[model samples]
Target chain A: MTATLSRIELMRGLVGMLRDEAVVAGIGNTNFDLYAAGHRSQNFYMLGSMGLAFPIALGVALAQPRRRVIGIEGDGSLLMNLGCLATIAMVAPANLTLVVMDNGVYEITGGQPTASAQRCDFVEVARATGIAHSAWAQDTSDFVRLVQAALERTGPSLIGARIERGPAIAQPPRDPAQIRDRFMQAMGSRKGFGA
Target chain B: MPSDSAWAGVVLAALRKHDVRLAVYVPDKVLIPLIDGVHADPFFTAFTATREEEGVGICAGAWMGGLRSILMMQTSGFGNVPNALASLAVAYQIPVVMLVSERGSLGEVNVGQVWSSRVVAPVCDALGIPHQTIERLEDLAFVVDRSIVQAHATQTPVVLVLSPLLTGGKVFAA
Candidate 1:
């Protein structure tokens, strides 16, 4: 699919579908877009790390088997830790969903071309890695449909949304501890906070 | 109580006492018994990581989810995971407990293993992550428990380097 969808719009759709589900956003634009689209206590934004959203979300999914967990990562960040796809497949937690924003460039780092910009197919890689519910979102509508399916079905789904080059609309809170505390409280894992 | 098996049991008990629910590891000869013990127990989730970085990622994620986790690797494997430790665990202040098997030390036969073992401690020092070497069986309980507790208390990565003298190292073909 030719990637022309706006990352911000897609992120908004993702946020709109969640009630109490947890979201782990990768570093850079993926984190910024999620915070810009909407901030929730359930969201765990990465401020420094790349290629870790999937693993973090996998842990959340594993710990809270009934709660849906979404991992949002950029193509460049995902490339850095591609083994996580295989690890995710190995554990295959049904409550997790992986959403990769593929802009084909490291947008936060001066727009350097990633492997996806050349010949990498993330959906294919995810599928080969054993995540059966892997696909490319054709557009915004398709993205919403896939997300709806992901939420409805018991699957470790991977959705690779090819996005247009752009900047994140806003920045998230800079404090990592505050972000961690709120998310833990939202998940009811931290005692006496939101409990 | 001076045997490797005795010390391994002590380390395992301390981990359980510290509420470590997940054990993420890359296979290593010195860690086999400890890995088996964690896997056999119902209280822990035993994850076999394809790479050391993946183990670090899993531990980081588990910590964020409020489940205590530990990462197990050999000396050489430590070289593969510093970026994740520095960027994800350290920068994000996610406490990580790493149990690394000392290789290339004492009677190590492999040239590569020896060279890499020398760098692990220096690397941990350079990363500014506190590391302790456990050489005697009696030290297992204190070192293991304290490192895990201190990691959570400080919200930073901590390493426990298991010396060849403690674990008997891994017997090599060469």
Candidate 2:
């Protein structure tokens, strides 16, 4: 019940909560962990981009208002574009949920300390930025509860999960085109190479 | 400002004809009329981005989710988002239509804006995105219309650099 659980376990709990919601995973371990949960066509795996998972998820949320969209990013990635928090707040898409994995370090890059390691609170930041449904899940059970509650809510939600560090349990295939096309197909908007 | 920024109207019309419904922009003086035009229209979903990179990411997401979009920023704004362009837009082949209003090449009074104007081509070239500069109203109707189609069809980001001659550039009062 204590906080600082494995990211893969957190991702598994998150993956279990979804019922066809599109997941846009940020680059690095965030993406790899999502793949470890299971390769759902509904997941969009970011390759080289940093700090864009939330922005991309906002786009999908706006595009398909009927379908829920979740953006999963790391603290390092999310901090790269904090301005997006304002944009998400302004738009206030009811179907979007943001999950920021706060590992306090860049786990993929040899555990380099990030601002989160220095006391930056993403939940407080999200709440102050006008996201009314922001919270820190203190443990695996609380993570599920927050995500479940977020799904039932009516506005944009953000969950800051403080996770334990470890190597990615698995990595997604390196094929960007296949990942994109497959996701498009799953979204029911597949256009091959240019349809 | 030009006594008539009739070109903004032309650009607006081209955007409408192309069915680009989502317009994410970082407002600029030269591009304000177009920004206002999109906001005023019911057919478009217009939003302001705090930075150009955020705008690019939004456009990429919109495209993936089946809504055609444009990312509008002035030339200087484009400089702040080359990484987003290279990583998200170009790397993923999202085909975001980036309309940049040129500043440095014209009678630019600000030293800050000059570098972005020159850097766009080489930067875009490095990302393998094809860029074209359009000056004059007569030429835009065709270029704007065709390039948008080409961008979507090819799955590549197309940078249309709008010249000062066309937007009347930005003016500083004496």
Candidate 3:
């Protein structure tokens, strides 16, 4: 029997998968919506920065080659640093997974239209940059399947998971500074081969 | 006399010796030799990014990932990176070492490069990012190593400017 999953459930499943395999160093963003939706992966939340998730993921992947590095990026955030996909393609780190949550707008700053709304195909851009694998998912099941597949594949991969556009969740009480410290501790661990 | 090729080797060695595992670079004529040298080194993972700001972001991420990373670009490209450096690197305390080729300085033929060159140091200063100019091969190792340390210790971007004389007084080969 096919089981349906909610967006929050899919995110939790993905985070659990990432944590189980020690595949993710951190999940970064300015949107609390991602954090509140049950993502337990270490937060590298951009805080004040709008577009830095992808490059940060690239750096982590390159640095910690033995660990799988996944970025939970927003479509709006991804668009701001779109050139990063080409850089990832050039480096071709087998450990990197870029999961872009595409909800069609900048949900955190209010429901504003993103360039993604203008029909810019992030998947095609990933392909054009020579990223060996790219996937698009429209719902929870699709996200789980595509994300699992992308994580298992080698080299740079991009997953554009279509999410519903909505208001961001209430802001968390955790201080951004504390979150940053926790992320650094997670990333600074030396158990990995490259580290 | 140090040929540009020899200087390139020196720079690459310094980076590796310092354990800089990641490098984010934008294509620049003057930086081609050094970039080629970096690409050939297995000890370092090099990324050719589309813009200077993106390189900065990548370097910051690499730093958080426990890799010492440097950003390489031309002086004219600095204008493309202030926001990334300020908002991302400076604000977040992400250390990124930047190796910038001096442009619009003595013997610069490009008018656009000249205009941007004058503001490079001041901009770096304004951002509170430490910087130094390297004009000779003898100065490369020390300056680069020091900058790397400063960047990591301060958790801020540091710029190492390579003057035309240091890079060779001609356009980088195509």
Candidate DockQ values, in order, are 0.61, 0.78, 0.64
- Please state the error at residue A90 of candidate 1 in Å: 0.7
Residue A130 displacement (Å), model 1:
0.9
Candidate 3 TM-score for chain A: 0.80
* lDDT value for model 1: 0.86
Interface RMSD of each: 1.6, 0.9, 1.7
lDDT sort, best first: 2, 1, 3
Model 2: per-residue lDDT, tens digit, B1-174?
Answer: 456779889988988898899999999998888999999999999999888888888888888888899889988898888888877787777899999999887578788888767889889888889889987788999999999999988999999998887888888886
lDDT on C-alpha atoms for all candidate structures:
0.86, 0.88, 0.72
Put down candidate 1 lDDT per residue, A96-176, tens digits, no spaces: 999999999999989999999989999999999999999999889899899889988887999989998988889987887
Please, what are the lDDT tens digits per residue for candidate 3 over residues A125-179? 8999898688676667677787778778888788776666554454444454455
Count steric clashes of candidate 2: 0
Candidate 1, residue B111: how far the Cα is off, in Å: 2.6
List where candidate 3 sits over 4 angstroms from the true fold.
Answer: A1-10, A20-30, A38-41, A172-177, A190-195, B1-6, B169-174
List, residue by residue over A102-174, the lDDT tens digit for candidate 2: 8899888899999988778988899999998898898889999999888888889999888888888789888
